[model samples]
Target: MTAVHASSESPSETRKFLVLLVGSIGVVYGDIGTSPLYAFREALRPFSDDGVQQQEVIGLISLMVWTLTIIVTFKYVLFLLRADNDGEGGTLSLLALLMKQTGSYMPILFFAGLIGSALFIGDAMITPALSVMSALEGMKLVTPAFTNYVLPLSAAVMVGLFAIQRKGTGAVAKFFGPITVVWFLAMAWGGLIHIGDDWTILQALNPINALWFITHAGWAGLIVLGAVFLTVTGAEALYADLGHFGRKPISVAWFMLVFPALALNYLGQGALVLGHPETIHSPFYLLYPDWALLPMVILATMATIIASQAVITGAFSLARQAVHLGFLPRLLITFTSETNTGQIYVPAVNILLFVGVIVLIFSFGNSESLATAYGISVTGAMVVTTLMSFQYLRSVWGWNTLAAAAVLLPLLVLESVFLAANLFKIHDGGWVPVLLALAIMVIMWTWTRGSRILREKTARNELPLESFIRSFEKSAHPPATVPGMAVFLTSHGDTTPAVLLHNIKHNHVLHQKNVILTVRTSDKPYVSDDHRATITPISDRFSKLELCFGFMEQPNVSKALAICKKRTELKFEIMNTSFYIGRRTLIADPNSDLPRWQDRLYIALSGLGIDPSDHFRLPANRVVEIGEQVAV
Candidate 1:
C-alpha cells in the first residue's frame, strides 16, 4: 500500500489506534465539518435586489445533498480512492501512475500534473479565509460587538492556530472529535426544534424543486449554483485523504456523524427562514437564544479552527508529494510525531497560510463576500479530477466501453452541475480563484520546466559505470588526502551523475575509493531498513550505490553514512568526506522541447528553490556547489 505509517502494531495497539484515528480525523476534517453555518444561508440570499426566494432555497439544498452523494460518496469512495499508486494518492502519485502507464507521453501527463498542482495551490490559498471567515461571520449574528474588531480578532486567532502547529496536534485533536460531535449535536438539536413547521419544505427532498427553480428563474437561478457550491467545499479532502482513514471509515463518518448533523442544521435554517422570516437573515446564529448567543459564538470559533487544520495538514501532505514527484524544489519537511500517521508540519506553508488567511479576513470581512473566492478553485479542481478519472479508466484501469461508461456516469453528471453552478459565480468575485489558479499554473509550469531541463542535461553527461571507474583512476586529479569515502546523491539509476562530474570538474580529484549513491524512492510509503540501501560493486576505485526509500523513510545522509560505516570495511566519516552538488545557470533554453515561456518559468523555480547544496543530506561546511553553464 502507498499509505503512510509508523509500524505494524499489535492488536491492542491497533485498538488504541482506532481511538486516535477518529480524533485525528476530526482535526483534519474541520473544513467539511462546519459548513452548515453559511453554505445554505448564502444559497437562499439574493444575488441582485430580488431577495431570497423560497423556491431557490429548496433547489439549492437538493443540489447540495445530491452533490455530496454522487461526488463524495460515489466518485471518491467507489472509484478514485482505489486508484492510489502504491498507497499514496495526490497529484504527484496520480502523475506517477500516469507516467508509468504512458511512457512516451510523460511530458503531457506532467503538464496535466502541473495544472492540477497549480489549482491545489489556489485551493490552499482560499481554504483558510473561507473556513475561518465562515465561522466568524456567526459572531455578528451572535452579537454586533464583533463588527469592527472581527478582522483583528480573527487574524489573531488564525495566527495563534498556525504558529503552534510545530508542537503537533495529537493532544489537541483528541478533543477535536468530541467537540465537533457536540457542535453537530447542537446543530441537530437546534434544527429538530424547528424542523416541525417546515414539513412542506420537506418537498425539497424531491428533484422537481431543483428542476423547476432552474427552469423558472433562468439566468438568475444559475447564480444559486455558486452559492450551493459551499455545501461540499471539503469534498476534495475526502478524495485527497482517502488513504488516511481508508474509504470505509471516512465514508462511515460522513454518513453517520457529519452528514446527519449538516442535514438537520440546514433543514432547521430553512425552517426558520420559512416560519419567522426575520430570523432567516442569519438563521445559524439566531437558532440560539439571546442569553446563549455568546456561548454559541465561542463554539463556532472553535469549529473554524478545526476546519483550518484540514487545509493546513493537506498543504503539508501535498507539498511533500510535490517534492517527491520533482514538481517542486525541495523544502524542509518535519514530521510532527513518531506515531500518528497524519501529524506533520511544513514551515514555509505555515507562514504563508498565516499571512494569506489574515489578509483575506481583513479584505473580505465576512463569509458572504469571501464566499466569492471559495467555490471557483473547488469546482476547477473537481473538473480536473473528473477529466483525470476518464483518463484513468482508459489508461490505468484499461476498462472497455461498458465499464468506462458505468464509471464515468456519476463523475460527469455530478461534476457537470458543480462546474455549471460555479460558472455563474464569476461575476460575484468568483473570478479570484480562476486568476489565482492561472497564476499558480504558470509558477508550477516554470518549476517543472526548469527541473526537467536540468535533469536532461545531467543525464546526457552520465558515463557508464565500468567506463567511469576506469577513467577516474587515470584522469589528472588530486590524490586522496585520507582513506575515508564520499557519497554523492543521484536521482537516476544510470547517468553521468551531476555531483561526481562537478567534483572532478572543480576539485580536480579522485578519491582512493568512492561510492556514487543514487537515491530511488519507491511509490510505497515505507521501506524496511534492510531493503533501504543496495551496494553495487563497479571496480577497485568506484562502486554504484542505490538507496531504495519509501515515503516514510527519513532521508538522513549522516545516519545512512553511519550505517555504511558499520556495514563496510571502508572508512566513512562526516569530517573526511566532502559532498559536491551542481548549480545551473538559468539561461533561456528555447531549443529545448518545452515552450519558450517555460524557459522563463525555470528561472523563477531556480530563484524560489533550495540549491542542491542545501537539499542534499550534507553538512553546510562540507558541501560545495559547482555552477554549470546552460543555454535555454
Candidate 2:
C-alpha cells in the first residue's frame, strides 16, 4: 500500500509541463494569491494613527514588492526548490535529504527540522482561518450589512471545507486550476485599472522606498513588516508540492503568472489608497468598481477556499511523513484518488485543524485580528528553512563553507529581522501559532524519544537471525517443521523477531519456509518497484526479507510481499502463508533513565496508533499476534 505520486516525464516536456503548470497554479499559488484580500489593509493599519501619509503607502508597497521578489521568488522558487529530496521537498524532506547526504544524525539538525515542521502545522491551521475570513470580509464592501455575517459565514465555509475532505481533493482540484487562473487574471485586471489613477505608486518598486519608510517610520514601520511577510506565506507550499507538479512547471507558473499578478494587485492597492486615502481601510476590495463588487467578493471567497484546501492537504501529507518517519504515532489515512497516490485524507488531522481554525475564527472575529497571529510562525519556518538549506548546500551540494554562507547569510539576516518584527506581535495575538508550534513539537519529540528507547531495548534483548539459524541447525532435537511459510513481522531486519523466538520456545515448531520480513520507510518520497525489496537467503527453509518504502507511501506488507514473490526466488502462496506479529505489553519502570511521566506518556501514546493488521493491510484470518510483556 505504499503510495507514490510521480510523473514519468521530466519537467522539460512541453505538454506535461503545461499541464502541471496549470495544476501548480491551482494548488501552489492559492495561499499567496489570496493574500491581497487582507495583506494590504493589515500592513497599512498602523499608519492609520498618523492619518495615512503618502510616503507610508509608497514605502509599504515597495516593501511588499521586494518581499515577494526576495523571499518567494529568490529564496524559495529559485533556490530551495532546487534543494529537493529525491524530487520531493518540504521541512521533513529537506531533513531526510540532509541525513542521507551527510550520514550525520546531529541533534541540531533534528531539532531544526522538528521545529520547522511544528511551525508548518501552525501555518496549516492559521492559513485557512486567515484566508477564509479575509475573503468573506469582502462582503462588507458589498454592503456593511454583511459585516455581522462575516464571522459566521467564514466559520460555516471552513467547516464545510473540512467536512468534504473525506471525499478527496481530486474532484475539487480539477476546478482549482481554472478558478485560480481566473483569480490571477482578475487580480491583474483589478490592479491594472487602478494603477492608472496614480502612476507615482510605481516608484514604490525601488528598494530605497522600503528602506526610507523603515528608517523614518521607525518602530511603526518595523511592525508593518510583520504583515508584509504574509505576502509570501504560501511560498513554502511551492516546495512541499514539488513532487505533485515538478520544479519547472512550478517555476513557470510563479514567474509567468502568479508573481506578476500579485505585484499588480499590491501596486493597485497602493494606488487606490494614495488617491482616496479613505480606502486604506479596504483597498483590496476597493480596487473593483461598484458593479463588480459583488462578483469580486464571490470570486475572492472561492479563491480562499482553494487556498485553505491546499494547506489542509499539506497538513495531511506532513502528518503521514511524520508517522512513517516514526516522529508521530500512526493515524487513520484514507486514499481519496486511485490515479494520484499523493491525494490522501487524514481524518484525525483534518478534525484537529478544523477545531483549531474554528476556534481562531470565533476568537479573532476578523482577518485583521488573525493577521497579528499569522506572521510569526511563517517567519520562524522561514528561518529554519534557511538554516537547513545551508546544511544541504554545504554537505549535499558539495559547496564550500564560504560559498554556502555567502548564499545563506543574507536570507538569515532578513528572516531574523522579520522574526524580531513578529516578536513585537506575540502579545497582540501572535501567541496562537507559537503555542500551537510548541504543542506539535512536544508530540514529535515524545514520539521520536519513545521510539528510540524502544529500539534500544529491543536491540539489547533480541538475538541475531544468523545465530538463531545456527543454533537450530546444531540442535540435538530439531523443531517439527510445518508444511507452509511463516512470515514473522519485525522492525529490525538483522535480529530474530520476538514472535519467532516465542513460537520456537513454547510450541517447539517452525514452518517449512520461515521468512523474516522487515519493513523500512526510506527518507525519500517513492521507492522504485525494482528496489522495493531485498531478499537474503539464509537457508532453503529460512530467508530474510527487507522491504523499503518512501515516507509518503503506505506500508502494505501484503502488496510488498506479492512484489517480492515476482522478483525473487522466494516462494509462498497467499492462502498457505501465516503472518506472525509481536505485540509488546509495557511495564513502566520508575527507576529507569526516562522521566516517569514521559514513560507513562509513551505507553499511553503507543496504544493510540492503528492496529498492526490494519496498518500492514494483512488478512485477519492469516495473521496471529503473539503478546509479551516488557519493562521500559
Candidate 3:
C-alpha cells in the first residue's frame, strides 16, 4: 500500500479552473526560465577561447534550439511526460507504475530512482545559492564598487527567503507569475534589440556550429557539453511539477512564453558577444542599454528568486512522492494554498537546504564555480528517465521492438554522452548529491522492509474474528476486576490475534469486560462522518469493533476513545482500562523462511522506530509492551 502525505488542495475535479492551472505553469517553469542568464554565455565561451568568429556563435544557438527540440520536446513532451503515474510523474512515480505493471519486485528500480531524486536534493541546495549569485554578480558590472559586498547581499536574501518556510509560499507566489512575466518580457525585448541590430544571429540556429565544434575538437567540445547541459537543468522540475498543473497548460506556457523568451535572450547574449567580444565578461548585462541595466538586474534577480522557489517546490513534491513510495520518512508538510498542489513547503527540507546553500555560496563563491556541480545530477536523472521509459514501453506502453528501439537508442546515446561529460566533474563537488541520494534511498528501503516484516509477522499468527472468538470462548476463565481491552491497530482484517492468545493463556482471569477494537487507516486522505467508525458485539462476554479513519487527517485517540465508549456498552473505563500490545523480538532460526538480512533489518528497524504501541493512538499510561522472543 502506498502512503499519502500532505497536499495543498488535494486535487479537485470540479473546480480545477484556469487561474490555478496557469499559476502552476509559472511555478513550474521558473527554474528553466532563469537559465537564460548564463546558458548561452557559457556555450559561447569556446568560441571566445579559440578566437572563433561571429559565424560560430550563431551555430551554437542553432544547437541550443535543437537540444531543446530533441531533449525537452521530443523526449519529455512526446514520451517521458506521458509516462506519468496517475497524475504524478517522477522517478518514484515511474517506479510505482512499473511495479504495478511488471509484477516483478525489482530492487534496482528503487535504488536508481532514489539516487536520481536524492542527488536532486543536492541540486536543490545549490540552485538557489548559485542562481542568486549569478544574478547578483550583475552588481559587479553595474557598479564595480558593489563587488566586495555581493556575498553579504546574497546571504541576506537567502536568509530572508528561507526564514518564511513556516508562513507558506501562498502570498509570495501571487507575484511569481507577474514578476516572471515581466522578466521574460524584458529578456525578449533586450534580445530583440540585439537581434534586430543583426538579423545574422538567426543563423545560430544552424546545427552546424555544434557539429563543427565536436568535429574539430572532439574531447574539448564534449567536455563543454557538460556546461551547455546546465541550460536545461530544470526540465526535470517541469516533469516533477506535472502533478500540480497537469500537462497541457505547462506545455502551452513553455512553448508560448518561456520557450521564445529564452531562445531570444540566448540569441541576444550571443549577438552581444559576437558584436563586442571584449565584453564577454558579462554579455547578458551588456546586451541591453545603459539605462535598462539596473532594472534588468532587478528583474533578473526576481526571476532567479522564483527559480529557486520552483526548485524548492520540486523538492517538496519529490519528498511527498518519496514518503508515499517508502523512500522517505514523514515530513512536516504544509500546504500553502486552498487550491493548488504547487504551493507546498517542507520545513525540514527548507532548513536543511538553507544550510547547504550557505555552504555552497561560501565554497563555490559564484555560479561559474558552482556550474561544475550542476549538470551531473540532471544528466544522471535524464539517463534514468530514459532507462525507466524503456521499461515503461515494454511493461505499460506495449510498443513493438522497432518503435521502442527507434525512441530509446538515440536518447541513450545523448544521455550517455552527457553523463560521461559530467563524470569529469565527479571530484569537483559532483559526488555530493550522489552520496546524499544513496543515503536516503538506503534508509527508505530499510524502513519499508522493516515495517513490512513487522506487519507480516503480526499477520501470520492472526486468527479471524470468528475463529478468535471461538477460541476465546472455548479456552478462557470467567471474570476479573480491572478491565482489559484488546485494541489492535490493523488493516485488511486478515491477521490473527496473537495478543489475545498470549493474554488469555498467561492470565486465566479474563477482564470483566473486554472488546476487540481494530483501527482502520484507509487509503483515502480524509474520512467523512459516514466513514468515521463501526462497532459490533461478538458474544455474551466480548465484542469486535472496527474504527475507520483517513490517513491524512490527524488521528485523535482520546476523541476516538470517548466516542467509542459512548457507542459501545463495554464495561471498560478510561482511567482503569489498560492496552495490551505485543512487541516482537526476532531471533535467528535456520528453519525460518525470511532472508537473514531481512530478519536483521526487522530487528534493527524495530529498535529504531516502529513500535506498535506508539503507532497506534493508545495512551502511553495505559499501555504495556510485552516482548515475545520469536525466531525469524
Candidate 4:
C-alpha cells in the first residue's frame, strides 16, 4: 500500500515543484530581472558624458556581470540559502535561529538583525518608486512627447497598486509567473540580436576587465560601481522569500532562466553602446527596432508593477515577523486568502509604503535621481546579512573561525565596498533611505526597551501563580464558585494575571474549572501539532495551559484550546468558556528609565496594538477585558 501510494503521488509532486519553479521566477526574480532597464544606462552616464569609450563600456559591463556572479549567484543562492531558520529565511528568521541555538541574546547580533530589517523596510518604500519610474521613463525613448506624462503615470500606477492590496494577490499571482517568463524571453531575444552588433563585447565575461576598470577609473569608477550595484539590488529577495517557494525552485529558476536572460540583455546593451556610441543615451530600449518600442514600454511597465508588488508583499511579511518577535507592537493583520495564510494585507504598512513612494516620485522626478537613493539601503541590508551569515556559519554549522571567515570575509569586503560607494551618494539623494532606516530603528529600539521595562515593573508587583493558587485553595471562606471554565490570558505564566485578580475582587466568584493560559511564540517557523499545547494541573479546579505558536504563524487561542481538549484532560465548550484579558492603559512618567520622548513614543506605539480578543481570535461575546493603569 505504501509503495502504491508513493507511485500514485509522484506526478502530483512533480507538478507542484514545476509550479513553484515558475512562481519563483515571477516573484523572486522580478526585481532583479528588470534591472537592465536602468542599471547599465546609469553606470555608463558618468563616463559617456564626454563620449563613450569601448574599453569603458566593456569594463563596466564586466563589472556588472561579475558583481551578479559573486553577489547574487554565489553568496545568496548558494551560501545564505542554507542558513535558513527551519524552512524560513530573512534577517529576523536567522536571528531567531541564532538565539535558539545559543540560548542567549547577543546584543551585536540583535542590532544587526534589527538594522537589516529596518533597511529592508526602507527598500520596500523605494522599490516601487524606482521601478515604476524607470519603466515609464522608457516612454521618452518612444517619443519625447510622452516624457511629460511619465511622473503622473508612475504615480497613478503606484496608487492603484496599493489601493488594490486589500483585495489580495491570489487571483493575479497565477499570471505573474507566465508574464515574467515572457519578459525574460523578450530580454534574451533583444540581447541575442544585438550581440552581433559587436562580438568583442564577449570579452566582458572575463573578470580581469572588471578589475582593470576599477583600478584605473579611480574615484569615477567607485561612483560607477554604485550604479553597478543596482544589478544585484533585488537579489536579497531570493533569500527573503525562501519560505514561500523553498530553496530548490528559486535556485532552479535562477540557474535555468533568470541569470541567462539578464546576462544576454546586459551584454547586448554593452555591445549596442560600444558599436553605436550614440545609443548610449538609451541603450536598453534602443536594442530593439523603433516599431517594438511602445510594446516593450507596456511590457516593462507590467514587469515593474510585478516587481513592486513582490516587495510590498515582502514588507507585510517582514512586519508580521517583527510583531511576532516583539520588536514591534501588534498590528492589524487581515487574511486575504482562505487557503493561504501567507497571503495577508497590512493596512498600516500599505499606507506607509504608499506615502513614501509618492514622496519619492515627486521629490526625485525621475529614476536617475531616485537611483542615487536606492543603493545605500540595499547595500546596508546586504552587509548586515553577510555579518549574520558569518555568525551562523560559526555557531549553527559548527564551522571553525578560520573556515567561516575564509568563506565570508571576501564577500563581506565586497559588500562593504559597495556600501562605501553608495555612501558617497548621500548628499545627492541617498540620505532618504538612511533617514528612513534610522527612524524605523528608533521605533524598534524604543518599543523593545519600553516593553522590557514595563514587563519588569509589572512583575515586581504581581503575585506568583503557584503561591496565589495555594493560598486560595487553603482559604477558610472561598469565593462563590461558578459552573463554567474561566481562562485568563497572561504573558508571564509564573505570575497571577491582573485580570484574574480583578475578577476575584469585583465579581467575587471563581469558575468550577479555571485555566491560566499563556501564548508563546516559538523560535522555529512552525511547531508540530503534537507539541503545540501543554497542560499542567495545579489542582482539580485549576490547571496551567501553554500554547506555542511559531513566529510565522497566527496565534488562535480558541483553536489551540480545541487542540488541548483532545491532547489533555481539559474539556470545555466555546459557549461555556470565558476568556479574561488585561487591558493596560499606560501613562508616561518623566522620571522613567526611558527619556520623555521615548516614553511618549512607547505609549503611542502601545496604543497601536490590536485588541487582545481580536488578535487571538477569541469569541468577542465570550471574552471579558479587565482594565488597569500602569506607568512606565
**Number of the top TM-score candidate:** 4
User: Model 1 segments beyond 4 Å from truth?
Assistant: 1-14, 47-56, 104-108, 458-465, 472-482, 498-508, 551-554, 561-577, 583-601, 611-616, 619-632
Residue pairs in candidate 4 whose N, alpha carbon or C atoms collide under 3 angstroms: none
Per-residue lDDT of candidate 1, residues 15-57 (tens digit): 7666645753575457776777777777766642555566666
Q: What is the TM-score of candidate 2?
A: 0.96
Once fitted onto the true fold, the runs of candidate 2 whose alpha carbons sit more than 4 angstroms away are: 1-13, 103-105
Q: Put down candidate 2 lDDT per residue, 1-632, tens digits, no spaces.
A: 12322343444466766778899999999988898988888888887866888888898999999999999989989998898888999999988888777756578888998999999999999999999888888888777899899988998998799989999988789899989999999999999999988999999999999889878988788898898888888888998999888899999999999999999999999999889888878898889999998998899899999999998989999999889888888787889998898999988899899999999999998888999999999999999999998888889889998999998999899999999999899999999999999999988898799888888977998899899899889999998988899999998888999999999889888999999988899988899889899999999788988889998899888888888777778966889999999888878976756788888888887887888888888988999888999788
Comparing 1 and 3 on TM-score, the stronger one: 1
- RMSD to true structure for each model, in Å: 4.4, 3.9, 6.8, 1.2
Clashing pairs in 2: 2-554
Q: Considering TM-score, which of the candidate structures 3 and 4 is the better prediction for this target?
A: 4
Candidates 3 and 4: which is better by lDDT? 4
Between candidates 1 and 3, which one is better according to lDDT? 3
Positional deviation of residue 110's Cα in model 4 after best superposition, in angstroms = 0.8
Q: Where's the lowest-lDDT run of ten residues in candidate 3?
A: 1-10
Candidate 3 pairs with clashing backbones? 58-204, 62-204, 62-205, 462-495, 462-496, 463-496
lDDT of 3 by residue, 1-632 (tens): 13343243445532465555457546877787777787776665655666756656666666677777778878886677787776667676777678767755477666667777777777788789878988998988888998888898899889988888667888887788778878888888888888765677887777777677556655656766777787787888767776666787677777778778888888887777777778776778888888888888888888888889888877877776665455544455657777754466776678778988888898877777777778887888888888878878987889876788787989889888878988887797777656655665566666676556556766676677777668656754643444445454444344445665677667655565566667665434345655566766667656666766553343555567777666656544667676766666767666545577755654554454334554455678877555678765
Predictions in order: lDDT = 0.70, 0.89, 0.71, 0.92
